[model samples]
Target: MVDNPKESAGRCAQVAGWLTAACQAGHTLLSEPEAKAVLQAYGIPIVETRIALTEDEAVQQAEQLGSPVVLKLLSPTITHKSRMGGVRLVLRTAEEVRQAYRAVAEAAERQAGAGQMQGVTVQPMVTLEGYKLIVGSFCDPQFGPVLLFGSGGRLVEVRRDTALALPPLTTTLARRLLERTRIFTALQHGAAGLPAVDLAALERLLVRFSLLIVEQPLIRECDINPVLAAGDHLLALDARIVLHSIDVPEIALPRLAIRPYPSHYLEN
Candidate 1:
C-alpha cells in the first residue's frame, strides 16, 4: 500500500505542532516569498526573480532580466492571481513594466482590503510548447509525501486528470507516472508543435522535489504549476509554496546541491 501508518502518525504530529504555532503567531500560512526562498534553497530550477520595492527598482529589474518580462504582486493573502488580475505577463518595456506594477498593486489593494503587498517580482518570460505540467507534494494522513503530476493551470480543475506516485522515484517510475496521465498522449504526438519532452529532466526534477519534501517537514505543500516542456528544455514558469505552521521546533533542513546530469547514464 502507498500509505504507511507509522510514518503517517509521525507526520500528523509534526503538522499539529506547526498549526499550533501558526495560531499563536496570528499568521495563516507561509507567504509566497517565504515559500520560494525555501524552494530556491533546494535544487529547484526556478526562474530568476527579484523582489522590487519601487517603480525604479522594477524598471531596473526589467532591464536586467531583458524585455518581455513578467511582473506580479507578491502577497500572502492572494493565491489565485488570475482571478484578481494580480499577474501581468509579456511586459516588453520599462514603461509597460511600471504600468503593470501599478495595476497589480491597485487590484490587490481593492480585492484584499489592505495591500500589505511587496513591490513586484520581475521575471523573464519563458516560452513553452510541449506540455504544461503541474507537479505537487502534500503530506497525506496515510501517506508521508504524496507526489502528484497532472496537466496544470486553469484546465487542472476542468480536466481533473492527474497521476500520483510515492517518493524515491526512479526515471522508469516517472515515465510510468506520466503514461498514466491522459495528457501524455498529446505531449508525445507534438500537440503543441514541440518535440518530445526530456523525460529524464522531468524525472530528475520530481525526485529532487520529493527529496526536498522529505528533508523539510515544515514545507506543508508546494506547487510547480506549468512546468513547461519545450523540446529538450523544461522550465518552471510559475510556482506556489506553503509552509507548515510556525512554532514547530526549527529542525535542520537538508540541502541538495545543483549539478549537471550525468551524460554516461543516458547511454544506458
Candidate 2:
C-alpha cells in the first residue's frame, strides 16, 4: 500500500483532509470505510472492499472482486457484525452474492432494528493459512498513546495473549515486543503444518502502525483486529479509529510523545 514514498505522503494528506472535516463536525467514531481509508493512507494493507446499497449492486461489486466474496452489513451502530449474524461469507455465484446481500441486510434489520442497516460491504473472502494477530493503539489515562500487539481473531479474549509497546517503535523494539508473545514463539518454528510466520514482515507492520499513531495524534484509539499473516503476506482484516474532538487549540495536541499529523508537509 505504501509502495511509493510520494504516493504515501499524498494519501496521508487526503486522509487528513477527511479527518479535518470530521473533526469540525465533532464526530468521534469513524465509519469502517473511513477507518480503512486511514489505514490505507498509512500504507497498511487491507482487503479490497466496496460498499453496495442494493442486492444488484452487491452482486456487481462481488463480481468485480471476483468469485467467493463476502458481504457484511455496514452500520456504525452494529460493530460486532458476526455476533449479530450480519456477515455472509463465500458466495460462489452471482445469485449467491445477491442472496447474501439480502441476508446480511435482513440480519441487520432483525438484530439492530429496522433502520439501523446502513448498507453492505463487499470484500474478497481471504483464506489465511497462518496466524491472526492484533495491532492497535489506545490512549491510556496515564501513559497517553500505547501500542498493542498479540494473538487476535476469535481467541483474543479467550487467550488474552497480548503485549504493549510505546509508539515510534524501531525494528529492534518491535521484534522484542513480538518475542514477548506466545504466538511469536509458535510461529518461529512453524506450528501445526502451517509455514513459519514472516517475522520481519510482522515487525515492519508493527513499526509502520506505530508511525501511524505518532503522526496522527487526533486518533484517540485504533483497532486493527485480525491482521492475517501467512509466510510473508500480511493484511489488515478489519480496522476502526476513534478520534478526539479537536475543538480547542490547546487540546489539539494529545499529551503524546510524538507530534500530530504533519500539517507542514501538506503545504508542499
Candidate 3:
C-alpha cells in the first residue's frame, strides 16, 4: 500500500480514524476510485487518461493525444471489456474516435443497463520493445500485501512465469526478485540483440508498487499489467485495482524511505 506522503498523510490520518469508527460500525471495505486515487498518489505511473462524459470531450481528448489512441468503457458494473468488445484501439482520426467512444458507451449501456454507465476513458498509446511487464498485489489472508512481477500482455495468463516478494523490499531484494522470474534469462540477454532493460528502474517500480500496497490497505488487488519499456523509459499502459471491505484488519504497513536506487545496476 503506497501513498503520497504530503498529500495522503492527512487522508491517512482521517482514514485511520474512520477505520476505527467503521470497526465499531461493523464495516470493512473501500470503494474502487478511492483505492485507485490512493495508488496514484503513491507514485505508481498510471497511463495518461481522462474521464469524458460527452462525445465532444472525448474527441478533444483524443485529438490532444495526437491520434492513434485507445478508448475503453469505464464502468464498475462491467469487468471484462474483451468479452463484450468494450475496448477499441489504434484510433487515428477524430471520426474514428467518436465512433469508438459511441460504440463502447452503447455496449456498456446495453450490457449493464443505463445507470451502470459511467462514460469512457481516452488514453494515449504506448510503444514498446520486447515484452510487457506486470506488477500486481494481493492481500494474502495470513501475510498481508504479497507483490508479484512478471511478463504480461495478452499472453500473461498463458505463460504464467512470475516472481513474488514481501513488503519493504530492499534494492538487493528487488534485483533478486527479477532474477527469480523465468523470463529474466531472456530479458538479460535475449535474442536478436535486445538491450537489457533498466533493472534498477524496474526495481524502483516494484519497490514503489509494494509500498503502495502497504500504504493503501483498502486495495484488495492492484494490477499493472503490460508496463511497457520503450527504449529506456517504462510506462504502465494498463491497470486494474479492486477495493477491499473496510473491515479488513489494520496492520502496520511498511515504509519505503530507503536509499536512492543504485545507479550502477542499470549501467551494465
Candidate 4:
C-alpha cells in the first residue's frame, strides 16, 4: 500500500525535531531505543523494543514480547554495553529475565552510580537463520554523505569486506553496489546449506537507506548493523544514528563525490 503523504511528512518532521533537540542538548549519541525509532519512522524494519523501569516491569515486558527476549541496559553514560556486561540475550523464562535485569542494573549502578542509568529495554529474539549485513552512512568532508554495505556483526572490523557508494540510489544502482561486494555472490548463490537472500527486499532497503542519508543531512553517521537477511525479508536488528547541525546553507555544503542521480530516479 502507498503511504499517506501527510502522515509520512509528519513522521519525518517528528524525527527531525528529535534529532535537532538531541544535538542542541550536546548529545553525540542517540540511545538505542531512540535510534531504532528514527529508523522505524523511515520505513525501516526494526526489532520492536520497549523500556522497563523496574524488575517486575522488565519481566512483564519480556513476557509480553514472548519467551526468549533480549534485555539491554539503558544508560546514557555507558557506550560499550557488551564490554560492561549489560546485554543479556535469550532469556527463555521469567526467572531468567529477573536475574538478567538485576545484573544489568547493578552493572549500570557500578559504572555510573545510582539513578544514572535508565531501566532496561526488552526486545524479542530475532531469527539467527540469515546473513548478518551492515548498512551505514557517514558524512565525508569532501563527498558529503557516503553509504556503506558490508559483512557486519562482531567480526565487521576483522572481516573488512565492504563497498561504498554515493547516495540517492535506485534499485538498479543498489544492485550494482551489492555486486561490487564479495558477499553478493554468496548472497545470490547460497553457501553452506543456507538459503539465498531475498535480494530484491535487501535492495529496496538500501534504496530507502540512501534516501534517508540524502534527505536527512542532519544525520552525520547512521549504522544499521547485523541486518538479518532471511525468510524473504530483511530486518535491521540494531541501528545507531549520530547527528550534527549544518553550519552552512544547504547549497554551500560539500559537493557529491560523483554525478547525482536523475530527478526522475527518486520517483521510482
Query: Highest lDDT: which candidate?
Result: 4
Poorest stretch of ten by lDDT in candidate 1:
252-261
RMSD of 1: 8.4
lDDT of 4: 0.82
* lDDT (tens digit, per residue) of candidate 3 on 1-268: 2334455567556544544454465433322333344445556566677777778888998988887888877775565565687889989999998999889978877887886657777887765565688888777756766889888777888899888888757667878989998878666666456666777777777877765565556656777777875446777776776555544444543233333344344332
Residue 137, model 3: Cα distance from true site in angstroms:
0.6
lDDT of 2: 0.81
With candidate 3 superimposed using the best TM-score fit, by how many Å does residue 222's alpha carbon deviate from the native?
A: 0.6
- Assess each prediction's global lDDT (C-alpha) against the native: 0.71, 0.81, 0.68, 0.82
Q: What would the per-residue lDDT of candidate 1 be over residues 157-209, giving only the tens digit for each residue?
A: 88898998876566677778888999887767666566777667777777666
Model 3 sits at a Cα RMSD from the real structure of 6.4
Which parts of model 3 are misplaced by more than 4 Å? 1-40, 247-268
For model 4, which pairs clash? none
Q: Alpha carbon lDDT of residue 142, candidate 3?
A: 66
What TM value does model 1 have? 0.78
Output the worst ten-in-a-row residue range by lDDT, candidate 3.
Answer: 27-36
lDDT of 3: 0.68
lDDT of 2 by residue, 55-162 (tens): 888888888899888888888677777888888888889989877878887888888788887788889999778788889899887777999999998679899999
lDDT of 4 by residue, 81-157 (tens): 76678889899999999999999988888877898678888999885688899999988887888999988887888
The per-residue C-alpha lDDT of model 3 at residue 26 equals 44
Model 2 steric clash pairs: none
TM-score of each: 0.78, 0.88, 0.77, 0.87
